[model samples]
Target: MPPSTVNRQWLLERRPVGAVAAEDFRFNEADIPVPTDGEVLVRSLYFGYDASQRIWLTDDGGYMEPIRIGEPMRTMGIGQVVASRDPGYQVGDLVEGFLSWQDYVLARGDGPMPLRVLPPADHPLSWHLGVFGVGGLTAYFGITDGLQVKPGDTVVVSAATGATGSLAVQIAKALGAKRVIGTAGGEEKCRWVVEKTGCDVAIDYKTDNLDARLRELCPDGVDAYFDNVGGDMLDTMLLHMNPLGRVLICGAMSSGYCDVKMQGPSNYMRICTYQLTVRGILLFFYRDRLAEGAAQLGEWVREGRLHVEEHVVEGFEHAPALLPTMFTGKQPGKLILKVADPD
Candidate 1:
């Protein structure tokens, strides 16, 4: 078969404020790139659309560099190695890496997460972009290894319906958390979080009063909190923290798109009063330990102990419109875009 000829990509047009707008992204098409001596040509199959990308656009102090304006947006994708000049990889190998949001990627195999062959077909390739991927690794580290939730302890998760949060809830329960409570935006999302993640209690932050609802659901106070959406959510959750409660700070999704200035948590004093331990986790900072985390998550997936929900959108051309869906709470699970399901 002849090699592919072109690639379509979504480029960053502008930085977003408060919420990402449509004009912030632009689509570009270019000739298929030929690989150098040690590189390969990868045809993208599944690409992740995570809420964390919003934070990546900002030049904030982070583990990774921000995606420059006018450049192809950065993403983690699963692809089949259609062509390779590198000794480490061969043609027809399936791999996952930080590929572009494009139909084809000229992978140099030099990125932080260089292309690695995909797992068994029975394991589901999409998991490389979500659960069993970065999201799952993050959840595993933050909960089991970071917070150390024990059996019969109360565990609460914010952004509970989201990709990482949902997995955290499940992992917490799987580790024997006596009660797992999740907080989400709407009634539907709250229900979905509990139903899918097997959380013991679910609260709708939109409809329920934060302090009161948390008190009602967790009368004994929260023992551990897996925080994904920061801002007011953290403040409320902090107010109900039990003595010696451990909080794993995951992502700041609530403020990821806030170009406008926003207030930090108002109840931070509670952390001192309750003698709480808050740990901020950036997955990249733990890259050396990712394989260990992935192994645990993979075991859970194989045993059917972990359930992953993937909300996939189709086409690279549709990526511009789809990336903003994470902020609107429209994506039910790990948001991904099927750039090319080419046969």
Candidate 2:
């Protein structure tokens, strides 16, 4: 437990108009909250950053409640149970779930994503917020179930350097994809994607002519496209997909996630003309199967088939500053902020 009695929090000061900035949050200290019946008091250890957090700031909150002003910033965090009023959780137990940008947070087991009791593992606890967390799990299901990528298929993943995209590339290969292609912004990132994630070819979206490259590299047309970027990239990929090809809409990083509104693919007509199967992935839908996904991911990791990457920033003060980097350029892999250590 933290020695300080006051809770350190970063509250949403105002709704962001465009890109989120650190000024949007105000730092304040308040008395540590106590858990009531059916509630668990968690001391946050690490906070995982996701693009969806920006959507949560919107009025609609996407699929969950909006982060109102004066409330602690919401995040998917790993924490230790310092106190519990719920029968399922006990003090000293470690958990992962929806927490907030504070030293202590009150959590309940009945939220859309319940508090998960983390079992002992040989991996680092932070791995639970990364490879075993949302990004890795999303990548697992998105490739295996959403796109149904199979052997001898040509698979392509955009934002190849991102947390989910990085893993999606490898998972597709593990599924026996004949050709695994990835898209990154530059030559360095493109090279890194191919080297680190086992991508057969990496397209430098910034320098290379994407359509031509896809035509030249994937002469048979892309069989499966794991789209992390929407907008123009989605439109381009739509035109290159083989008949009966599959597409998984995982994210729209192109929009910057500033507002809820996003541009739809202009070449969506190809979905009909080519008889393509397009699907969207929201981890909430596969909440029950998360363990199954994680288990497979673990096996692949142990077998040296999957690579895990993380960009960890220390100190809670850096939380607000790190969020905007998701839209801007950031290093490859999962982005995490270390707040405190568990007792």
lDDT to native, each model: 0.81, 0.92
lDDT of 1 by residue, 1-343 (tens): 2236767778889876657776788878788887889889888888887776776777561456878888788788888887898988878788887887777788876656667776565666788888878888889889977899999899998888888889999999989999998888887887788778898878887888888888788889889999887888898889889999999888887776554245779899988998999998777677677778878888888888887899877656677787778887675678887766534
Residue-level lDDT tens digits of model 2 in 1-343? 4547989999999999889999999999999888999999999999999999999999888878899999999999999999999999999999998999999999999867898999898888999988899999999999999999899999999999999999999999999999999999987898899899999999998889899999999988999999999988999999899999999999999888877888798898999999999999999898899889889999998998988999999998998999999988999999999988888
Q: Model 1 TM-score?
A: 0.92
Provide the clash count, candidate 1: 0
RMSD of each: 2.4, 1.0
Model number with the top lDDT: 2
State residue 109's C-alpha deviation in candidate 2, in Å.
0.7
Q: What's the distance in Å from true for residue 223, model 1?
A: 1.0
lDDT for residue 162 in candidate 2, whole number 0-100: 93
